[model samples]
Target: MKELFKQIPSVDQILSKKEIKDLIDKFGYPLVKDSVRKSIEKVRDEIKSGKLKEKIPEMVFELIPLKVEEVIKPSLKKVINGTGIIIHTNLGRAVLPESVADYIKSLSTCYSNLEYDIEKGKRGHRDSHAERLLSTFFNVEAATVVNNNAAAVMLIINTFAEGKEVVVSRGELIEIGGSFRIPEIMKKAGAKLVEVGTTNKTHLEDYANAINENTGLVLKVHPSNYRITGFTKSVPAKDIAKLCKQKGVVFAEDMGSGNIYDLSELGINDEPTVKESVNAGIDLISFSGDKLLGCVQAGIIIGKKEYIGRIRKNHLLRALRVDKITYAAIEKHMELLLREKYHEIPVYNMIFKQAEAIRKEIEEFISGFKLENSELEIVETSSKIGGGTTPEREIGSFALTFNLNKSPEEIEQYFRSREIPVIGRIKGERFLIDFRTILKKDIPILKNYVSQLLSH
Candidate 1:
């Protein structure tokens, strides 16, 4: 161990190496020096653990550049969604319409009327672009965009129920992705939580009993990630809205995975459209922009002007406001929706893509796809609208099933480590790359990766 420690090059010695000098030129001296120190530390650890069989300084020097590259490499990159999860939260939910890229780029490269009203040649609000578009789709008096749906929830709760009681159904208290619970958010917003109803059932009377003089809000949370099966009963949003109206209490809903598209024809029937909630007379409602909306990350707040106007005035809205890039992406997405070109939206495109259409594409790809060392076949599978929207609902889809001498885990890792990671799933001892979540253009890219994997 003493000899191995001595053999490991010092940070200075490693930085002086020709390979590392080139890295320093590329990434600068501080980053290369840091990487060299990390490489030397790793070497010492490996030697102490008996993982290093040889005490060679050349071996240490050889890895210093790799460490430098890893340090400088980006952690966020493009990934192929072959997992059949459309609104996949882990993979950046809501694939924006391809048409929005140029607009986002144009705004990013140059500044326009992000806050300036060009028509009046004076200062203006940035939310006007998307807020104007949101009004046309929903029967809402006002709207605003925040950083995310969670922030919107916090902002609204703090604005309305900070010093009062917030009534929520026991069954409707949802823990969304990342363990963000409704009760916890409400508490953080400084609202006293009063949970009504049982886990499986909550009635209008329970809500009625929970509301009183101190009740400032009745929050209805839609659990998008899971479903309650038989014997489950929950009160309708309309009834709650009416009750809140009668009591003069603010009624708001955290409608998880807010859907605007009418997907009943595509077999996605359980999730209600955002228009229904807007039309149902909810005073305030908040939802994710990147989930079902197929836009950038934003917390879209839409409802009656009486409440929305108050939320807009909250100083916290400034803290939770989105930037110009998000506004541009959202503005373009709404434009496409307004024009009735819903198919241009990636989420809708994937949802509306029939199983037969994907199978046909798979069949065409499989006809010429040859793997000398593996087996590939077209198989029936179900795609999920991930990102906590309709968790139990499955869409009919097809996948390219893979069977190789290597374990399914090994096969999965091979594709996941590619230049553009191809994320898939393992089930029934087979690895499947579902085409539902994959764009038609990406199939060829995947084919190339599979072919390259075969060579290895």
Candidate 2:
């Protein structure tokens, strides 16, 4: 063991080797040195543990380049979304419109009026950029944006209901993704949560009864992720707004998905739109920009100018404000929405795409695959509107189910091992490919990947 340890080359000697020197030329000195050190340490440990059978120099030389490549690989590389969950949170919620990337690139190359007003030649508010667009689309008085939906909720609570009672129904107190409960958020924002009515039912009178001198705001939360159907009753937003008006308290709603247009036309009738909430006379409303809106992640707050003005003045607004990139993307997405270009946005396109279209795409994808032992067939599957929106509703979709010679787990692993990993679901001894979430451009890539795997 001592002789084997001594036989291991020094870091300097390893770096001087032709292969490692080539890596140094390609990557850099620091990375190559680190990789060599790690490889040497690993080989020494293995030798001590009696696991290293190869000669020390051969093992160290072989492992150095692999370690260097591993170290240089990016952590946030993009992956193909074969999973039919539109707005899949883990795979990055909403795929922004390609125009958004163009906008970002254009902005990246040059400076723009992110804050300064070009006409006035003076400092301007960043909120002014998207405020008018949001207000116009939603028919609200004014609008502002923050980092995300959670920040929107927190800002509203901290601004209006901090250190005061914010009335809400027990049923509307939902726990969003990652254990973020409504009650906990309220507490964090310095608001006293006043729960009214039972989980299954909360009437108008319950909200009216909860209002008192200490109450600063009446909050109505849209439970975006889950639905509690069958014999359930809750106070409508209009009624809640009316009650808050009578009580002389602020009425605010946290619409989780931030839907701009009515999805009911596409058969998703249950999800409400921002227009409806604004029409209901809710004084303040907040929603997500990334979910149903098909834009980058942002928390859009639109409401009466007086209330939005106050929210902008809150000290925490500075901490939760978005940067130029977000403002730019959102502005472009809003323009697309205004122009009625629904197909431009990926989320809307996926939701409204015909089942027949997806099936055709799948047929093309599977036609290129000549698997000796794998059988591919088109099967009917349902795609979900994920990212905590419309939990119960699933868009009708088509999938290519694969009955491979290998186990389902092995097939899944094989696709996952690709350069841009293919993420699909497995069910009942077969691997499934839901084509709704898979873009048309991704087909060639998928075909090449599958062909390569079969050839191997």
**Which candidate number maximizes lDDT?**
2
Relative to the unseen true structure, what is the C-alpha lDDT of residue 210 in candidate 1, on a scale of 0 to 100?
Answer: 90
Model 2 lDDT tens row, 64-147:
888987978889987888889998989989998998879888887788899999999999999999997888888889999999
User: For candidate 2, which ten residues in a row score worst on lDDT?
Assistant: 367-376
Q: What C-alpha lDDT does candidate 2 achieve relative to the native structure?
A: 0.88
| TM-scores for the candidates | 0.93, 0.95
lDDT of each: 0.86, 0.88
Q: What TM-score would you give candidate 2 relative to the actual structure?
A: 0.95
Off by over 4 Å in 2: 15-22, 369-374, 453-456
For model 1, name the residue pairs that clash. none
Per residue, candidate 1 scores C-alpha lDDT tens digits across 1-456 of 686677776677766778778887888988878877877888777888888868468667767778877877899999999999998888988888888978899889886888999989899988899989888777688899999999999998999998999998887788877989888898889999999989999999999999999987889888878888899899888998898889999999998788887878867788988889987878888999998888889999998877888988899999999899999998898899889898788898898888999999888887776556447788999998887877878889999987666788999999999899999999888889999988877877898887776666
Provide the global lDDT of candidate 1 against the true structure.
Answer: 0.86
Weakest 10 consecutive residues of candidate 1 by summed lDDT = 366-375
